[model samples]
Target: MGLPDYIPVKGSITFLGKDITRWSITDRAKAGLTLAWQLPARYEGISIRDYLRTGTKGCSERDLEESMDFIQMNTTFLDRAIDKSLSGGERKRIELASIYLMKPRLAILDEPDSGVDLLALREVLGLLRLLADQGSGVMVITHREDVAAGCDRSYLMCDGRIVLEGSAGAVKRYFMSQCRPCDGCEVGEVMRRG
Candidate 1:
């Protein structure tokens, strides 16, 4: 989606009851809206601690450590450069930690479950729930049943359009039933037939 672009188009985007469609990305960040990209940008020279501290101005050392702990990150990572040196899961966790520090009013995560093992996936889901509990609206885009299960509502999309929207369980059940593979079945064809 073009949400992070921070440019105006045909549609309007409202956050916290205000129109932010034309707001600059910096402005949106200042207004407590943030996005965690699926493949976060690499900061070759910036240490993890420096990067997170930049986002969490005035936060004490204990606060930073607690944020890392919430995401299950080892304290050692704080000294490492946020570059290719880190594993994919490590990078993902660090990106999520940034979100926790920013404490955005709304967070849009793009495929948070991708490339991570089951254990990391569970941690991501836990952090997402924590964000919601902390009053941030989380919008997760994922195809994984477990991720959807962790969400309050789920929307099934086909060809860029949502074909189903309901409680997570209902949407998952419907998707499983309708999209299951058969000898000659294709997803688009099955969707059309259904």
Candidate 2:
């Protein structure tokens, strides 16, 4: 919870077998822990290609093109600035492509499925599966059952606490049966009732 603020927290956060509870955001990133924001930030002057190449060393042109293809993005996006000109879904896909290039040891994606179309969602799901199979630990924060279903494990959080966690199928079932539309029901209330 205090990750961005770098506040001293009570819990332990270990990454790649090292303690990172008190690590700064930059340190955490350098340690191969990446958080893809739900709303990705805009970098006015940076081209999408330059942005994707940030943490990716020794990446070839083919590798970059392949990453974009994996996310179903066109090569034309490479020269465009990572700014407000891009749609939310475009930014999300670009962010995902960057993560794919980085191949971090742990990837914490916040609502990656939000604003994405069904086709793109499937591609994202496939990429996520591939990332997991390639040995990166992916923790996707989402309420979507489809996204959860693709995950190996799922954790349901309510009122800032994880109330249920298990195999994706089990957690998805509990979420679908117990929680109403997020707009129609408060998570705390659902937690209390369940």
Model-by-model lDDT, in order?
0.73, 0.72
User: Distance from true position, residue 83, model 2, in Å?
Assistant: 4.0
Write down the TM-score for model 2. Answer: 0.77
TM-score of each predicted structure versus truth: 0.80, 0.77
Per-residue lDDT of candidate 1, residues 20-61 (tens digit): 888999999999889877777677788889988887678777
Q: What local lDDT does model 2 show for residue 93? A: 78
User: 1-194 in candidate 2: lDDT tens per residue?
Assistant: 21232344467877768898888998998888888776676677889889888868898898899888977888888888877767766777788888888878888877777778887788777877777777778878775667776776666665445778786677767777986644433442111100
Provide the lowest-lDDT 10-residue window in model 2. 185-194
lDDT of 2 at 178: 86
> Which candidate has the top score in TM-score?
1
